[model samples]
Target chain A: MSETDLKLPLDAWHRAQGARMVSFARYEMPIQYEGIIAEHRWTRESAGLFDVSHMGQLVIAGRDAEWGLEALLPADLAILKDGRLRYSLLLREDAGIIDDLMVTRRGDHFYMVVNGATKHGDIDHMRTTLPSGVVLDHMTQQALLALQGPKAVDVMARVAPGAEELTFMTGGGFDIGGVRAWISRSGYTGEDGFEISVEARNVGDVAALLVAQPEVKPIGLGARDSLRLEAGLPLYGHDLDETTTPVEADLTFALSKRRRESGGFPGVQRILTELDKGPIRKRVGLFVEGRQPVREGALVVDAEGSEVGKVTSGGFSPTLERPIAMAYVPAAAAVPGTEILVEQRGKIFKAEVAQMPFVPHRYHRKGASA
Target chain B: MSVYFTKDHEWVRVDGDTGTVGITDYAQGQLGDIVFVEVPEAGRQVDKGGDSAVVESVKAASDIYAPVGGEVIEGNAALADEPSLVNTDPEGEGWFFKMRIADPSELDGLMDADAYRAFLADQ
Candidate 1:
């Protein structure tokens, strides 16, 4: 509630746009611009501009930068090429997930992007555990914006020609109208887009420029949540937490081959064990049968009405036009086509274990078939 | 035609034995982009202010209460696939159901258009 907690760089821009503001994760952000569903479909078809400046940005640099980072996360920082981004999770000593973050190698410095809610604790943990020579500098004044959709690349290409050549997970520094920004071809909505990190003072001008484009519409946090949910990506606090491991969260792909073999990252022993021996409960997608969409904290029950697991994130998927959810179910029941039941409001609704990405993901992976 | 409103936001326009029921504009605005509506089956007996149907939006679900006691004679099935009709026309084509009034005398207790308009202002 304190004013010193956090603020988005585009706070004034949001107010000018008649956005209905809401408090989220210590930062005051726009909850809706036009409306949730309108912005959601606009992003799916055209393009939606999102103000994601609430996310935490940090730079990890030192003579032994790669070596220092390996001690905290379970990803191989040394093997990551410059300008390439790798999705990773910070793990505790017991292999529990501390935070899911993105690590991008920018020459001698490693750029870390973490969830806004847990960034404070994550930075503190890293600073205390890092070696004496390493330094963790928080980029608190940097503003982040995501331009996402099928036409996102074209919109960016109009101003920054270098952006079209950037593949997914790659980023580079670019100058746009006297404003220097670090643009990365990455986003949470499963669409092909760029997350631009710019100085706080110039973020408003940059945002205004993007919104002026014919294909771009201002999106708020409401549509951002639905887009990610339809994409089957997990939200930090809801689908993942400190008690969940990378393996249990079904995020093993985040770990690279070199890191798995080197076994130098924190909690690698337990993580490897879970990898070898399958986790007890795995995150799986569910297709709810009835009109009633099961919400979070709903109990997953078996044939005889015995609790098996818990629902992490559940809602109606606007893209699929049906009710879909993500739940942690027993590994044995995690297979696609397996029958399950979700208990909500004392009634058990029939559900089926289905594949992730209830709607087919349309990421712009180079040479990959659509 | 006299329109009476339920505290649950449903409005009933009574014309002798037949009554047209639908959600108010305020209800539609609060629900936001309704994706699906579960209308009660025709011939189902519903009491006044009873849970009779459901209106689902992209974010959440809300149950619709019967504005006056009656037996549902017909329902708008077209809304199943095109629920946005409720947002476009909450009173006309978006009407949820038509009920045969159980007691015509109950209409006296309902609010008129002027009273319902005032009810919205207070909210």
Candidate 2:
């Protein structure tokens, strides 16, 4: 928010496009381009391009990069094939989440994208713990863009003719709009989409190429948040934090079978024990019953009005036309049909514990139709 | 018969001792797509410049302070279903509530249309 805020690669471009810039992770980013609700609906029905260059992209390589990473993360990196991406989490010694990230193996090196706010801390943690044989390079000069939605594949096809061939969670290098980029069929919006990584200097061409397509419009962080919230994806700072564990966050799926059995990672024992016995508190989705939106810092109160849990991420879901939220409640109150009492600013609301992915995911799978 | 505005962007349309209050069009435009509004109910008493109503956009929630002290006469129930009216017709149908003006002298401390326009420009 200050004048000292670092500029994104597309800072001038965003300003030229009438985007409202806000400070995030020390970088000034576009919070909205046109309008949040309009851009949100547009992305749901069509295609939207997002400038996510703020997220840290790191390349890990050398002798034992795979083994070095597996020792720190919970995912089964041993089985991850080349040109594929797997969602994984870095854990603390107590099984608490350090950060949720994506790890992709591209030929000889593994590329990891971590949350922007925690990238420096994540890199520091890895550098101290990883074996000396492994090398981690922070690719600060690379800019990332995500083309997401129902028509994203079509838009991506037009940008890079062969990129659409890669299915969900897969990636490869491609020349997009004459600029070389590592394009992947992966995104945060729970839709058929692609994440493109290109040189910061060359990203303008790639962005122009994607947005030039009729289906694609430039989206912003504001819509990006609402889209992911509707997708039931937890944001790192808001939903997944240092005090929350993967099991408690209902992210046990990210803990691969091999890692669960071999127990080599940080806090492997604690995580496995919780997985078996069930965590005391569980992250649950809420279907807020009213039109008035309940926001973060709202308390989950019991009948007696005592605080039992807290809302982490809560907002109005543009697609659902109602308010929804995510909270960590007692395991007993985390059931699908349980009534959740949420209190905000002296007003109480009735919310129901609902299954996540509030909007049905439309990822383009191998055999299933998108 | 005339309107006075508060620095906070609320406008009070005064007619004798009764006043109708709501946020300004400029305020609504800045808020961008208000999804929810909590209007003051009848019989409620509010002080000038006190936080009174709640207006929430998709991105954030903002408080609409009372432009001047008053006793609430009627809440704008129409806003419950069509909150976007605040965006489309903020100075008209989007009026939040009708109130009995506590003191006509309170209007003397507020800005007229010309002064409010100058205030916005200064901002």
Candidate 3:
């Protein structure tokens, strides 16, 4: 490890568990324990504990914090209810996405989680953009852990008791083994899970307690990437960037109906225009024909072999047992059944545009059928 | 028959003028799960250090380089369906291809088992 590389609170724990550590977002984090495929399968079948402390946790405080955040983000923060989380995007003035984040209305203040790679930039952007009264607090003292899978609720209930009552996208404070934690029933994987935020001092102990359960195993960044890719969730630096607008990224759902009509946020003109006429390019899922995985940066070509778009994220899905990718194709070629050719290493492979979340999302929403 | 290794972690078991090629156990361990393997067709001429095959894991794809100049005799057919065989038994059943050595002198330039083990330690 380099002198500049940061270490997580569970860095020692991960190394002790035989994790292969790699430099990610300036942190020497675990990329895998036993293996990526095994870990990915275990998370889908049961429960997996992930150390995601590298993600930035921030709190937006002060009197008009909601309205202050609304000026910068396209989402309608005022309509966001207390204890509820909304997936929102931080946008540039030109309608490009700065970063995709999760914002939860925590009664008095808004708690937000941003991607680790862009967290510093996100904090700086918010600090400069928001009014003087609105305060941005980088919660560097906290560490985030995700307990994800189908049996995640069972495991959470076993440890934290009242955490089972918190449905998908809802978060509240809880006590786990005398350590206070903010637990949310949400995760990047398309499974029913929870993301727990605790003090850096208590994270190691909390992680150890969770992994002790038979259902939960320590998962690494390798499985986390594959799981989210299979879930059709976009990684920030890869699938999303400053040049890609929310509309082009197929994340128009993040823009509330009220926000769309009111037209207050940045890039409203370009965003509303795209919303009306549709974006020139669209992000869509791909089903590769052969077993050979078409990786990111592979070109998407049209019938005449002309370059149309590029794949953003691609990987072999452990759950589906095939190669899957997400790419931005021209709007006309973005249909679910449209045929497209992917070029990689001077070879052209057949692929078809498919609907996202290749595996259906199994969020544990309240009053929903299991 | 004697086995030779390359600095890139490719191995070749030499039998007269013919040799069977596969990656070393160390390389397979680093690759984690082997999802797919694409080998060069039979009869294709391969130069020393040339790209011979493609090995893919769930996370990334890597190119397998030819350890020595040879004429491809046969690509492993079993790996088309059972790529993980490379992970299970990399040196034996996981052999990627068989080739006819173009120049036997190339084998003299390759590393022996002891030298290869020492090379791995340096890495």
* Candidate 1 residue-wise lDDT at A92: 90
Better of 2 and 3 by DockQ: 3
Instruction: Tell me the tens digit of each residue's lDDT in model 3 across A1-370.
Output: 6789999988999999999999999899999999999999999999999999999999999998988899988887877889999999999889999999999999799999999989999999999999999999999999999999998988988899899999899999999878899999999989999999999999999999999999999999999999999898999999999999999999989999999989789999999999999999999999999899999999998778889999999989998899999999999998999999999999999999999899988999989976
Tens-digit per-residue lDDT, A1-370, candidate 2:
9888889898898898889899999899999877899999999999999999999999999879989999899888888999999999999999889999999999999999999999999999999999998999999999999999989988777778899898888999998888888999889887789999999999887787777799999998989989999999999988999899999999988989888888899988888889889999999999999798888889999999999998998889999999999999999998999998999999899999999999998887777755
Q: What DockQ do you compute for every candidate structure? A: 0.37, 0.83, 0.92
TM-score of model 3 relative to the true fold? 0.99
lDDT of 1 at A86: 91
Worst 10 residues of 1 chain A by lDDT: A1-10
Candidates sorted by DockQ, best first: 3, 2, 1
Candidate 3 runs further than 4 Å off = A1-3
What overall lDDT, based on C-alpha atoms, would model 3 receive against the true structure? 0.94
Clashes of 2: 0
Using lDDT as the measure, the top candidate is: 3
